[model samples]
Target: MSRLEENILRGLNLIGYNGPLLQKTQLPVAIEGGPKNVEYTQLVNFLTNEIRTLLAIDEEVNAVTSPEDSVAFVMEITSFLKELNCPYTALTDGLVSDRLQNVSDRLLLLDYLITELMGARILQEKKPEKKIELKLQETPEGADMRLILQTLRFPKPPPNISITTLFQKLCPTIPIVLNKAGADIVGEGIFKGFLSEKQWEILGGIQKDLYHEYKIREGNVIDTIGRYHTIFSDRTKGKNELFEKIYHDKRKLLKVEPEIDMADLIAARTDLAIIEKTSNSSVRKNTRSQLQKVIIGQVPDRGGRTSEIAPPSPRNAPMATTVLWWRKRRIYTWGREYGWRSSIQRWL
Candidate 1:
């Protein structure tokens, strides 16, 4: 078996994949040669399923029989990689080509993808799960009684009383006080017409102060009742503020951008540099040849017909020149030729 095939099988085994047996005889003769359509289709389906299983993806895997199918398959993989948040790698037209000819390239890509996924799986397995600590604090000494008094600010309970005893004495009066207050407020509103405007104005001012006091007392009562059940540290103002700050910090951490994958970044930069160099070299070579052609004059063809120089069409433009255009159009093209698409998509 070829080294690539051996690596693929080893990775599959390591990942606990139990699929159809892949053997040397079943694989293509040459690494660069396309395998039979049937074999290629089966292999793609199997590997795709394996990938889905590893990623716990619920998407259905389709069989590849034609170029369109190949394109769809690649698109599905692109989406899967995206969901995984793997470095984006363009893998569309560049892999299959317009004529749908590069079968070997697609096969090689599948091998690489499986390997990357295997590595990702291993890393994921090795990663320790984060545990969030729930820090709890007990109600401190001398603070409990003080908290109970603060919560019952509305009705001043006698000092030095136990919490249970205070509640026992105060509970019966709570409903009675609330009902009497409600009735008095309602009666005042009904009988306000009988009072002079000056008297009404004075009562309004007193009512506002009473309303404010009532709100404070209401809050205190609720807090005291809550303290009876659970002595949460957040009930204390200082600890509550501290916890808020800590929670805000955690939120900020979550909002912070994820770390960039250096390997993918470097690889993408390298590919861009290579493409830029190739594009520049091609332009220079073309320019020099065109100048030479003009200087030397037109040469006659073997059929006695003179060939005329024509302007290069936009369609014939170098892929590098259209890199920005591709990005703008969001036409992701992948394969060995456009490896830079991986990291570039992240920026998009």
Candidate 2:
């Protein structure tokens, strides 16, 4: 029997399962590196740990000489493996091999040794767990995993319980695809299952900022959004007129209007002008004070309306008088030299 088949038979016997050997799951045993190097490394680590546990069981099996003591050893191994849910369980068929059937009487030391040897040989030959020394050999011709992961983390949500739960589901199931053929080999589609708007923005920003060899693959919306956010995000929030202009443009596109128009300089001055014009017009001094309060955002009811003089028509308004009072305050002061200054001052 092949080494793999031998191990399967032994594992079945030790687990106290009686079954004909059917077939094993077709997991690729080849260790030649490919795009799945990261996954390969992780699996190798897992398998190495499994082998170590099995070796410990083998030592325990050797210490017992009596058949009854051996059975106890086998039971210990079985319980340990059951907890691990190791691949050995999935490899067995239902046929009860004599080596396996006899395991019920005493621990199957011979079979366990054979199985461990096969596992060790496979592990030794396919040493995927060897720590790889990665260095930036050159400016990469394509995507850098380190940089990509770094940039992609932005624009993603501020992680909380919801994200933690979702990531747990992703890490075990998905094969991480490394960029090789080109940097752009990494596409946004790879992240589609977990990408959010925030993450997209972050990744996109990185792509733009790095401008390193790679571009995110075409047709990947996640990457596209990330790129867009990088290109267009407003990082500044204070007194930015350019941002205000851009904001206004978007509002126009989206048909949104602000609750208050801070940009309406003319309107603000118009209100101020009303208070000024009404102040100079023949009206009760107290009434003008109340009107000024209303113009400045405090409203109050004044008694019956006086026969208020009409405000000058915009066209016929005295040219000099039309100037803002503050601007012409000094020039207007010249008129104060006339008795109107003293008379108006006393009118207060």
Candidate 3:
């Protein structure tokens, strides 16, 4: 027999020697009236035995009840095929060949089945990766929780892991929190009116604080909430002071200098809405000063430089005007006489 036929016969024997006997049943078909030579008989025997061998391998793999047994059968078939040289035709035919061919076929039947099995086994028998399990205990008042449990009886990971593949599998399950500066961050108007009354009160305080600190670098209402708003308005003016108190002392660790990045800070403020929208209303010049006095009177100057500007005493108002008149202050310019009248009459 040729080397190829000899190897085929040996592969057939690996399953059981019953394959050659089964091929004998179909021997008469090869021995037709046309073939009357020794070469024809040899050809018939080779064809019959080879066909039977393939059939037997297919039956053993397909009918095998246990997965482990099926795996073993396939591995042996593939090994034999590989020994005969990997023939791609065997896969297209009724059987499998090439080393690991049967195992590969079984794996292809199910998505990620073979990969999971190998990963699980390697994780158990060897140290491949760091596997940690998180367990949350049950509480009577809380909802029931079900968690998948896996036991990895191993040590540290080997540094040979493929980083490109590792992160692809690990990243999806990790949770992330987006920016909390409300609808402005997302550029949507839907969440604007949803703030509670308490939130508005807190937001008002933040707006005022940001105006004082970063007015040179203006911000919007959204930034007011995110950058300046405080949970406790009375304890301090804004959240910036709180952040400063916590991290300012650790300036070296945080890498923050007294000189601020005015542009970025301003952008954050504008995005958060610390600055109010400008109104187009025109105020009468006389009424405007009076309104300013009323507003300035109501606003409490808490430790700021403006607190030192004491308003004129009730008795000093007349004396102050007399002193200004004695000095002949420019009180009756041509514009002043008509300015108040024109302003009152809604003329300018």
Candidate 4:
């Protein structure tokens, strides 16, 4: 929801209501070489913290005696695990004896132990008959157990596919994909089975908060700025700046417009140009499918959603040559800009 809201905010910026949303807000006074004051890193970190708070998952193994404890202990642990909704393998007595009793055979279950921190093991009975007990042992460390639990919290792993790809090739970054998945699950009323009432409320509250915040920013508060600020993003869902909407607005920063159309000047149409020109959904998708990664881990100034349809970074592998050069030159002059947050330090 935050990502979506951010996209909306960025989209607004591209459209050129360059004015700060409120009287108190406005672009910073243009600063030529002075540093940009931004708190994006803190903001992303805050959002992550919110997610951690929302999940509030406790994946730790509870304190207890060894696996040799009474039957009640076994039953209790089993019940606890059932409530976790996490995948775990339980070894039967026979399975433990065959796989764990022999030193050579133990290798077969090593992976299970490493991943789950628990596996079948042979244990001597405390009885006078001196029989045997097979059980799962408590791992020497809790790291693996916690890791497994932590991953389940997201429910959706980050996508391996590129965000700009026409087809879903890779997943977007974690917060975006995971939260989005969580939101969808909520929307479908499926999360009710797993998420508690409070959890649902918390998450819903977050979404509402995000939405309200977006409304406030758009309708009330403004992003005042007054200096050249480099923008960067993880580029999830091809987090576009929607250059087309804001092209003319951005032009104001330039002393004069280039002879070429802003879109052409930026060569906004490259590989995706042909299909992008058409309004057909299929062709538009193909145009969106195309994506190029930022070479140096970041890109400058998002023009807007499908704004320029060009890869950022004028220095290397730019989609546009002269157009890109001037585009960047204009940004250089604007002094104020918006971008995906990479760190507290804009460039960092």
**Model number with the top TM-score:** 1
lDDT of 3 by residue, 198-276 (tens): 9767766766665566543433433443454234334345566766666445443432122333323323533356443
| RMSD for each of the candidates | 47.5, 26.1, 22.9, 44.4
Q: Which scores higher on TM-score, 2 or 4? A: 2
Ranking by TM-score: 1, 2, 3, 4
Q: Taking the candidates one at a time, how many backbone clashes does each contain?
A: 2, 16, 14, 28
When summed lDDT is taken over every stretch of 10 residues in candidate 2, the lowest stretch is: 26-35
What TM-score do all the candidates reach, one by one? 0.29, 0.18, 0.16, 0.12
lDDT of 4 by residue, 1-348 (tens): 234333434533433333332122221111110111122112212222332333443422222233343233334333433443425444223332231233222222222222222111111123246459888676734454345436545343344634356123233453465575774442322122356779767766666665555565543322322131124345534433564336446644543212332223222323333344476886666655323344344468756777557666756555467776777556654544554333323532
Name the runs in model 3 displaced over 4 angstroms: 1-6, 20-235, 240-348
What is each predicted model's overall lDDT from 0 to 1? 0.55, 0.42, 0.40, 0.36
How well is each residue in 29-113 modelled by candidate 2, as lDDT tens digits?
A: 2112211223322332333345656454332212233334434433444444444343454212233232134322112332443
* CA deviation > 4 Å runs, candidate 1: 29-61, 65-68, 78-90, 93-100, 130-348
Q: 1 or 2: which has the higher TM-score?
A: 1
333: Cα error in model 2, Å: 32
What TM value does model 4 have? 0.12
> What lDDT would candidate 3 get against the real structure?
0.40
Taking all chains together, the TM-score of candidate 3 against the true structure is: 0.16
Candidate order (lDDT): 1, 2, 3, 4
Off by over 4 Å in 2: 1-50, 53-74, 80-107, 128-131, 134-348
